[model samples]
Target: MSNDDGSMKELVEFVAKALVDEVDRIEISEITGNQTNIIELKVAKEDIGKVIGRQGRTADAIRTILNCAAAKLNRRYILQIIDE
Candidate 1:
């Protein structure tokens, strides 16, 4: 029932790859809840720029997609981008 797992993975990869030259070692975690879904992302320092984009436009877009997707499922989602 968690198709978003794949969606989460895709989104993570997209952001990570866009922000960094390397594609490996990108980690994304999803917390499912009746009230809201939380997505945590961990990326390498070198690739942080790609994840955040110029003025965080890329990050904003990713969050928007997550919010939209979760809303379709009658839920709320939050994307938490962490540096680790």
Candidate 2:
């Protein structure tokens, strides 16, 4: 992974941690590909709705920020929110 990857991961992690009641239960995994990157966000089961928000708007906002950042780096990003 490059420095940009690290920063992007940190960005997702930072945002996810802030949305969860159990910050310690939050986990993010990055799967790097040739053309696109997949960021998997996992938070406590009880906090899933909070992260996903009403009508998934919160998740969409996070994804929007990620895509904007990825565009500057000439990359593509995909966010997947999961319960853990």
Deviation in Å, model 2, residue 25 alpha carbon: 0.5
Query: TM-score of model 2 relative to the true fold?
Result: 0.96
| Candidate 1, residue 70: how far the Cα is off, in Å | 2.0
On residues 23-83, what C-alpha lDDT tens digit does candidate 2 reach at each position? 9998889999999999998899999999999999999999999999999999999999999
Candidate 1 stretches greater than 4 Å from native: 4-6
- Which residue pairs in candidate 1 collide? 19-50
lDDT of 1 by residue, 1-84 (tens): 467555765765575666666567678887777786677888877777777889999889888877676666676778888776
User: What's the lDDT for all of these models?
Assistant: 0.73, 0.92
Query: Which candidate leads in TM-score?
Result: 2
Which candidate ranks first by lDDT, i.e. highest?
2
